[model samples]
Target: MIFDSLDVSYGDMWGSHQGMTHPAPLSRAVAARRHAAGMEYAVLLSSRERPLALVESWPRGKWRVYLFDDRSWRMQMIDFKPHRTGMLLAHRNTRWQFSTERERSSFKWDVQETTTVLADGLVEMRTEFAGPRGASTQPLHARTSDRSSVGPEPVPVRLFPAPVEDFLCPAPEFGDWQVFAPFLAQQGHEPATTVVLNDVSVDEGSGPLRATEIEQLFSSGACDTPDGPAVVEPVDAGLLRITSGRLAVSDPGWIGEPRTVAVPPGEFLVTLSLLRTTYGVDVAAAKVTFSDIPPREWEMALRPDEDLGLLGEGEFYGVGVDTGTVAFMDATRAVIEDELDEDLFIPLDGRFTVELPGAESEPNLIAFRAGRGDGSYPVWIGRTDDGQVGCVVVDFQLHSSGAEE
Candidate 1:
């Protein structure tokens, strides 16, 4: 009897019976052995490579067979009728008869069958059965004989626990308004809404105004406005000057020509109003709120202005930052090898989750940038599922930098 049980038993367990069909001759032989009376026997068959079959004959002429076909893609069982001759020819003849006819003839059938008897007296059979256009070929074959030989014991299978739930890493936190404010201002620029400052200049000794100096100037209450107290803060490569009320200026040094600038209260208010409308958040509050979230090392695909010195190496240098692609030389190859697509590349857009060996949770955000222009380099940032957070930078030049010439 063929039984499907959910629980694992002492005997072998075949998971699913779907797409399973009987192997004609072998199936018949097994059925005949089931009815045979008072027969207790054991048979083992082997060839040059390994054991081919292990058969046990029981009382009432019944038999139990464990056959392994090394050539088949998946595991399948064939039931067969016991032949009186007790020879391998009994199994071969079953194949010929089944290959010639079909239980359902409306479907066209094409078969390819072959039988070979090795010099060691082991018989090998191979048969392919094909049906309609979408029908796949079913290959089946087996060998039987009276002589028995001992084969190696079967290896036990190990099962692993299923994953509990899917995890998602938090998105990388971009710098507060220091980075986003400029991006927003650049995007907000338009011919119809352009604001021009007549003249502006600051004497900060030569070179350029350092961020520390700008911050000091703002905190010192050097610049005051009619609306209220005003402050000038440093952000990125620019300065943001805002009044207690509505007057404000972004990217003060962006234009380069303005040594000194005079601003009309009405016009200043209008510009500040526009900026407020565009950002939809109080500039100071937004900056404060974002600052509290903790800054992560994340930059856009086209931007990589951060610096790395002796402590660590730079990002990969192949692909450009604008390509939205990053490649790791040999650093992350093992980590992402199995998850790579046809091109051997994985997308950095967080569309797919990767299994990092020790990761416990997915990163919040992941970003990549090419350290160079060749498209072979990669730099990435993410919080690993294991709750680790950091950046991975790989560059061929860095690798060779320390090499003795």
Candidate 2:
């Protein structure tokens, strides 16, 4: 028998097969051996420096292979047959090649079946053989019949369990309206009718389509809208003031003459051509809403004044991981001078959920916890590589076990 049932029986569990003699820590040792068997060499062609590394076994087999990029986590496997001399490569839907002692030239071939076994497996599969060219025409005969009485039973397909159901993180809901950052529109594959953000370096969309005009308007904050009195007032050199609603500065660096824009009641759109500080020239747009106030009741709802300091650091900084809103502490002496008696909500680790506006997007909320109430907020906002913005809250209490202090 080529394989001893008591030694290398792979498929299912039987009586004595489970009784393989293993030393102390047997389970871990066995797991480590299996893990080692699952490792394979991969050469990442893109990177110049450290281009080679040991990756999980390629879907193909327990051997070495080359990949153009080390990007995707999942991969497809390639099938092969070991020849009597070395190895015969079989590739029809694969982008790889192989070599052996019998062939020195590189060539491509359609899928084919060859009556060959590994150079090592050949020792048992060959009949008559020469000195160096070990096996030739004849194949070794097996005494056991293909339908032997003691042969393993044909395993039913139902032996394997069906794949686990895919997990979908709970989507976020909005009471009325919300704002969203840029995210890639995965179109139909992910969520189409819901909020979707763009996060791709390439300006072109992922699927076969062009970005919507709304996205273009948001990217370059400049659009044509009917004139109205400006409700925002410039408070200082670096800050501006909005009375009650949020301030949407299309151009961060665009500082024009101080002017007022009277916003109408109910749903309204305010467009501007703002400038960014860093890049030479870039513009984006923002949409604001005042649902409670009716269009005709604009004068009664006008609260056109602001504490300019709110427009600075806290406006763009200290974004909560879950809430998708920028929060900051009133650390300034001015607010404390008046004895505001408000809780100084400093950034501590916290998480909140967010439903990006416009396109269908996943709900990203925020959560954070404190470690001994360290006064500092644990949650902070950061930009992803694809321009998608997100937040993360940290809890110091949970980290006590690993704390160096």
Candidate 3:
């Protein structure tokens, strides 16, 4: 994972010994190098070469490192915590820092000479790497644990991109979106697209949306308008209210430190709600509605007397008695193909009258009984604007008092 060390070319003077350890004897020298009683190049005395620990003359603590070239430099270390009570310093000229956890657990680093403080009263140590001056030395302090002094844990704040710079991508945030019927219509057959927070972008004439050159609008600010919340009211008058005001959307931790809310996905009418004067101002609730319009009559047709038995298959064309005044109908279609799902299908206080121009004055039975004796009955067909189909039934009753001529 360390990109820098991936391409290190070992020189002849440096020979790598995996899982190698030397017994103490003080031979004065070995190969072309020599080590005194306290001096050594690299030591691997642990049982295994894993949790591999490096024994460089250096201090140890929690830290993050970036392997640049063949050198391991500490990039960030806010507050490091050491596991063991030991000091880290560099060797005479060949000290190295092992960053891999695979090395830390296996290396046995022994105690070396500790430096005393003069004025500050703080003990410190100077660690070496590569050569005597190969690494930097830092002031060391004793680690302490204070339970009573603990404060609330710091909540994590994440910037979309770490180390934000000028001309780079601007910080992303949510925007307020209002409902517009025209925009909703553009949604086509797909479910209405609800709006959500998106990155600041500009539409270019050609290819894709290019990054805008202007600065971010709501980096920080607040405002109270006489009208209402910026993203509160509907954007377009054409947009019909579906759900009067039963919708809301929120950010992660909009409540406490880490909260999440639900929001529909689609292009929306939004406004800048983040205000500078206010503290922690946010768009909490978003109210939205869907369109609901009763289907209108489109067209109508007439069916022959012979076609009466074949009902439900086609629209109710028209009904007429053979020898009676035949009542022709002006066919009108149903707005939607699906039957009304709710009892509300027959709108409350809403009714329409169908006048049969010609029909038998008196009622009859037998062949006139339109129903199949069960609940099923013959029907009339009608069509609607969007090719939706509808049906109506025509039943005949026999009147014993008014006998047919």
List where candidate 3 sits over 4 angstroms from the true fold: 1-247, 251-253, 256-289, 292-405
lDDT of 2 by residue, 13-100 (tens): 1121122211111122222333344322121111122111111223223222222223221111222322223322322112322233
Per residue, candidate 3 scores C-alpha lDDT tens digits across 1-405 of 111111111111112222222221111122112111222232211111211121211122221111111122211111112323432111111123444544433432221222222223333333322212322222122112333434332222222322211112211111111111111112121212342322222121132111121012222322233323232211221111112121121111111211111222222222221222223222211112221222244222232222322211121323332221111111111112142212212321131111211123321100111111122111222233554432221222110111111
Prediction 1 global C-alpha lDDT:
0.24
Ordered by lDDT, highest first, the candidates read: 1, 2, 3
Estimated TM-score for each candidate:
0.14, 0.16, 0.14
What CA RMSD would you report for each candidate? 33.1, 27.3, 34.8
Which rank order by TM-score, best down to worst? Answer: 2, 1, 3
Q: What does the lDDT read for residue 192 in candidate 2? A: 27
RMSD of 3: 34.8
- lDDT per model vs. reference: 0.24, 0.21, 0.20
